[model samples]
Target: MTIRILLDTDIGPDCDDVGAVAVLHALEKLGEVRIAGMTHCTSSQWGAGCLDALNRFYGRGDIPIGTLTMPGFLDGDSGYAKYNKGITLGYPNRYQTEPAPDAVETMRKVLAEGEDGETVIVAIGPLINVMNLLESEGDLYSPLNGMQLVSAKVSMLIAMGGHFPAGKEWNFEMHPASAAYVVAKWPTPIVFSGFEIGAPIHTGRSLTADLPDTHPLRKAYEWYVGEGETRHSWDLTAVLYAARGHHPFWELESGTATVDAQTGANDWKHNPNGNHAYLKAITSPSLVAEVLDNLMTR
Candidate 1:
C-alpha cells in the first residue's frame, strides 16, 4: 500500500523546501507514496502559488493546496513574494490569482478522508499550522475537533525542526509557541529531523547539472544559491525518512523533547514514556547526500 503524506511547509524561507517537494514527487512517481494534501504555514502570500506550481510541474496539479489565513499570524508580509516570485511567474498556476482555502479547513478535510491511523504528516516547516489545527474546533469539513481528528487519522508526525540535546533552529525559532504547543499536546508519536541530522548533507550541485533550466526545482535552486551551488538537505532528509520509514541512512533516538516558547531552544530527555524521537545519522553523510541528490535530480 502506498503511504499517504500530508505535507505542511514554509516554502519561502529556504530553497531546501523546493528540493523536498521534488523528492516527494519523485517518490510519488515511483508509486511509493501519495500526496494527501499540502498546507503552507508561512505568512508569505506566494506560498500557495509556489506549491501549486511545483505540483503542476511534477504532474500532480490536482493536489489540494491550503494556506494560513490567520490575521496577524505573522503580521507583516512573510516575504514569499520576494523569495518565490520567480517560481509563481515562471510557472502556470491558478493559485497565483485565486487564493487557497484556509489551512486548518484544508487540513481537516484531508485528515477526514484518510483511514484511521494511516496518514503521515511530514512537516518541513514551522509548527504554526499544525498547532492551529490542533487547537481548532470542528467545522464543515469534519465533526471531529482538531485533536480528535488527528488522533483518529494521523499515524505519525515527522518534523524538521529543533537542534539536538539543546539548541535553537529556524523552524522552531520562527514560531516557538506553536512548536511547544504541538510538541506537548499532539496525539501521535513525533519524530524530528533535527538540525544536526541534515547539516552535513549538502545537495543541489547535481540538481543543477541533471535537470533542465526549465525545471522549477532547478530554477528555485538557482535563485537561492546560484547555479550548481549546494545547500544543506534539511527538509529533504525529513521527507526521505517520512516516505521511507527506517534505514541504515539514519536511526531514531527515543526521548521527550521540549521547546522553550520564549527562546525557541529545544531540549531532550530520555524519558521512559517518551513519545518523541529524533533522527541520528548512521551511514556517512556523503552516502546519504548521494541518495538525496539522486532522488531530487530524478
Candidate 2:
C-alpha cells in the first residue's frame, strides 16, 4: 500500500527536518509513499520559504503548504532557513518572497480530500498545528468538527516529541497545554520518537561530502551546523517510522504516555491496548546513519 503522508514540521531550528524531507521525497520517488502536504508550526517566513525551495528542489513546487497562526518563533532567524539568502540560483520557489496559506485550512483540505483511514500525519516538531487542526471546526469542505474529521479520515498520528522516561523536551515544553490535550484526546493511535531514541543515530555528514555545492539541502546543512558535522536523526527517525514502521531499525514500547502538567516531562505506563507507543532504538546508530545518509544523498 502506498502510504500517504502529511508532514508537519518545525524545520528552521535543526537540520534533521531537512533530512527528513529529503527522506520522504526519496521514498516518494520509490513509490513507497505519497507526499500529501506539509505544514509549518514555527513562525518564520524564511523557514517556510526554505521548505518551498526544498520542495522545488525535489520538483514538487506545487505541493500545498500551510503555516500556523501562532508559530513558536517571534522575530529572529532560526539559525538556518534563508537558503536562498546568499546564493544566486534560478531556483523555483513560491514562498521566498510570497506568503504561505493558512495551515489549518490546508490540513482540513488535505485530510478531507483523501480516502478515510488511508492518510498518515507525521508531526516532527511542536504539536501546535496538529492541536489547532484537532480543535478546528468544520467549514466549506466537510461537515465534521476537527475531532470528527480526524476520526473519519486519518489512520495514524506519528509525532517526534517528548523526552520519555521523564524529561522536558522542546516539542512539548514549548506548548504543554496543546501537547497534553493531544496526548489525551487525539483520535488515532500515536507513536512517539522520544529524545533518547534518535539522539545517537546521526546523519547529514554524507550530504556535506556527497551533494553538490548548488544543492539547497547541502547549503542548508552547511549553514545549520557547519560543514561535515552529523546531526541527530530526530526528525528523520520519525519520518522513517512513518514511511516504513518499526522493524529492523527499532522496537516498539507500548504504553499510555502522559505529560506532566507543569514540567512537560513524559511518563509512559505499559499497556498492551494503549493507543501510544515509543520507538526504542535497536538498529546500530552507525548502520541507521548509513541508511539515512543514503536517503539524504538521494
lDDT, candidate 2, 1-298, per-residue tens: 8999999987777778888999999989989899989998877665566667788889898888888766445326535444434321335667656688888999999999999998899999878789899999989989899999999999999999998755778888877777888998999999999988789987887776798987877887777778888788899989989888999988998889998656667788899889999988776889888888898887
Residue pairs with backbone overlap in model 1: none
In order of appearance, the predictions have TM-scores of: 0.96, 0.94
Stretches off by above 4 angstroms in model 2 are: 71-90
Per candidate, the number of residue pairs that clash is 0, 0
lDDT of 2 at 62: 81
TM-score of 2: 0.94
| Model 1 misplaced stretches (Cα beyond 4 Å) | 71-83
Give the per-residue Cα lDDT of candidate 1 at 298.
Answer: 81
